[model samples]
Target chain A: MSRQQRHDARVPIALAVLGWLAVAFFVLPIMALVLRVPWSSLSDVITDDATTEALTLSVFTSVITTVLAIVLGVPLAWLLARSNIPGRQFIRALCTLSMVLPPVVAGVALLASLGRRGVVGEILDDWFGVRLPFTMPAVVIAQLFVAMPFLVLTVESGFARSAGTVEEAARTLGASPWYVFTRVTLPATQPAIVAGAVLTWARALGEFGATITFAGNFPGTTRTLPIATYLALESDIDDALLISMVMVVISVVILVALRGRWVGAIGGMR
Target chain B: MGWRNWGYEVSLSIDVKRRIGATQLNVQFTVAIGETVAIVGPNGAGKTSLLRVVAGLISADEGRISWDGMVWDDASSGEFSPPEQRPLAYVFQDYALIEHLTVGDNVAFGLRARGVRRRRARERAQEVLDVVGGSDLVERMPSSLSGGEAQTVAIARALATEPTVMLFDEPFAALDASARAHARRLFSSMRSLSMARLIVTHDAVEALTLADRIVVVESGSVVQIGTPSEVLATPRSHFVAEILGLNPLSGQLRGDELSLGAMSLTVGAHGVDDGEVIAIVRPRSVSLHRERPEGSPRNVWRTTVEAVDRSDGRVRVQLGAPLPIAVEVTPAGFDALATELDGDVWASVKASEIVVQPA
Candidate 1:
């Protein structure tokens, strides 16, 4: 064989080894959790009330938060991606700030702006008879704030990639602006939207610091799975390990089912 | 002001301004109802911009466009209709088929967007597909279509909208030779569908054969407007001549003879001075002979063949040294002359066939 052909064959082999090494590094913690869990005490931990309540609240609030993100963030995404509005760069940077901010920092920012003695919270208590801190709504709001940037960033990138020619063709063919958006623009960005939703839902499910800081741990209302697992780890290690396994198992199942779709959407964008 | 007698016509003179760059398309022309006018120019010649202005896709910063006695855009009065309100259909260069939708759904998109019933939209899509000779391609996805099939579906989609004005921007630019011929034939055979048809192309053959009138644009302005025969017969500018494949020679004229790059040719009655002048001669007009034929033609020179390249069914032979002239001849003509490689030849042209214009 020629020298160039031998070099090409060796390069791919080296890359494959590096890729497998990275996968093994990521899987180490999950493998440890599986190895350390006690099989005999699994049934007892499953019957515990705190475990079930945290799982239920986590599912309920994460789904609600994702819906809120879709309702509020899609328009912003469209604007950032497609329009020539003034100060667009600054607005885009501001929107992406939440994605990189620590969850605890996000929780603190939310508290300063929406706590009882804070900006809008004081007026809400006085005029609307409402208290927001340490409540279920607070949990939902914190999750929404931290997770919405994921959806907006994904969808905005999608819009940027779609060629403007198709939209112009739609307009010249007697489609109104709204009609064009609903028909051509929306369908083109659908895969991005779905992928963003999946990522945001997963992030919200695993959220911890923001939920605890903004909405304190309560038995049935505010304590989601991550908070419950932390509290159980402090008092009962067996129960905490079992609850951790449940989180790992559920997330693994979801990721496995969605692997093909995720890869397809990401590859299509490229 | 008369409505019944006059048909749909577009008269536009456009000037647009933007921050990055600007286009001042000060073009004034008319397209009679049911007549096909082709806009031909190089890239960045503002052909698509002019079409966009007519289609109401973008408002001109200055000037006006009137259609059938109705004002579509008037800068002085700030009157402009949105694109959706215009009676136009535009076929983009990419075809722009919706990827997620099936071919039938993509074609039916405009009808559905206009509030037609779903079943009626499907029936209309089928009917339009039949017109474009693509009836069997309805159920397939757009991702599965070949370039030609997708373009046919795009044209069918445009036709389904029942528009008065049809605009196509470089629709054949992406197609291969065979596909381009098919598109050209399909476009030429379409009749009585739209009130006005405007196609923007850079291909000379497309402009010559498809248009009743050809408008040549260069540097965002119209340089010439005439029938294809007239333009090809007497090109107004160098760009136009180059696009139409006419050989342009620049030199000086004294009395009846013209002096060019190391060669001399005779002219007609008119005489030009030592000032710069452009001499245009069609490739088909120059005849190559192995021997200098005894003739009354004013221009005959002894030359040698340097190189030859075949294009389509014709061979373009380049003459050597003193006059580097390129002449086109059919394969049969070349064979009949017993043309040899790098051999001595005689080039003859009539004085009346050469056009000399001031540079």
Candidate 2:
């Protein structure tokens, strides 16, 4: 064999070893859970009424939360990435603070600000007869608070990578600011938006502490799969395992579909 | 449709100040109907900055940009039109083709932005693409295009807009030699048909070939403005001479002696003086004779061949020793001088052809 050929052959094998190590690290716990799960009780656990309700609520709230995040987060990402407004850096930092905060801490902060006895909550209850805590809205708000940052961060980075010259060209071509943004800038940044949306939806699906604390984990309203899994873990291991497996399967399916797209989107930008 | 003969009349005076940057583009120039103006300068000489100011991409702190008797930007009067409102199109150096869009779509982008209907915009875009020889690649994305193809698409897209004025920022810089040659030919053909073009390029060949008048800018100022022949015959600044590839040799010409720094060479012509004089000499004018003839036309120097470079169809030989002279010769001259090493060679130049300018 040629000297150069022997050097080139080792690269793929070395990369393959690292890839296997990452896979093993992420999959070992899931593998253990599936192996220990009683196949006989799996059908019974799936048939549980509370489990079905929790699964339905999980999907519903996660979808709603992701939608809300998109509506607010896309504009915020655009502003953070493109604008030279005052205190923009501070606002961007504040948006991503939720990503670093513990879910319980985030729930506490939300409760203090919007609970019935809390500052705005007292006024909302007295003036408008509105109670935000222990509601489905609270679950969505909690999920959005944590997951929206993922979307904003991902999309903002995409915006940062995109050439501003294209936008300038559009403007020179007689496009108004709004037209340039909507037709040119938005389409260019679509892949970033999609990847960010997927990440946010995944994060929303896995939310637990904030939702359980602020929304009170009601079966038909806010008791999502992660909450139900935790509650089931207290009393029944088989049900918890099954619920966990279901969450994993759903997340894995969505992730597998989206991973290729995310890679493709980023690669296209380069 | 053919462009209207709207003779360019813009009285522009710009003064801008920012935190870490400032640009002062204060100059007034006019172009005749269908005239092509070339802004020649190095990067960051405020050439692009001036174009931006005129196009209304950036408003000057204190300036008035009145094009064709219409005020695009008048800071004192608080009149500033956005880039979109201005009837101008710019071809960026990078081509700036929308990567996600097809060539046809990109060309159509400008028309659509101007509120043109979809069908009409596409038809116009197709017409332009045909002119630029890019009709076959209309459906192709920007990623698939070669450099020349992409540049043609960019120009086609710009031309499709049919604006009153077209600004190009080194449009041929990214293209290869053949592509640049083709682009020059394309511009020459479109000169009579298109609107007034303002091309910003450092290439002398591009300027001389495509521009009707050249505006030489350096250090945030317009150094010289003239036709290609005028600028070539007489360059105002060292920058202009360097850019045009003319060797601006400074020397004192007194009586029959020309003092070039420490060295003094005797010339045939005697009427010249001391203090601040530039000698403009073309490389092709200097001859490398085998020996110094008894009677010859003008200045002579015995020098060695420093370096040799082949360009276009000619060979340029760099002379060594007391004075470094770049001399261009044909293939035959090169072949004759090929065997000659780094030894002595007699160099002679005509006295009349050597243009002298004030320092």
Candidate 2 deviant stretches above 4 angstroms? A1-25, A260-270, B1-26, B243-359
lDDT (tens digit, per residue) of candidate 1 on B1-359: 46544663443333443111465676767776677889988888888888878888778777777666667788889998888877778888889888888889888988898899999999999999988888999999989998988899999998888877788888878876456656755785664554688889986655765788899987678889998778888888776776556666878877667889688898653333456777767778889887878865568888888888887789888888677778888988888778677788888888766755555
| Predictions' DockQ, in order | 0.60, 0.63
Q: Each candidate's lDDT (Cα)?
A: 0.81, 0.80
lDDT of 2 at A84: 93
Q: Against the hidden reference, what TM-scores do the models get? A: 0.80, 0.78
Q: Every model's Cα RMSD, please?
A: 10.7, 10.6
Q: Given the true complex, what DockQ would model 2 score?
A: 0.63
Residue pairs with clashing backbones, model 2? none
CAPRI tier of model 2:
medium
Name the weakest run of 10 consecutive residues (lDDT summed) in model 2 chain A. A261-270
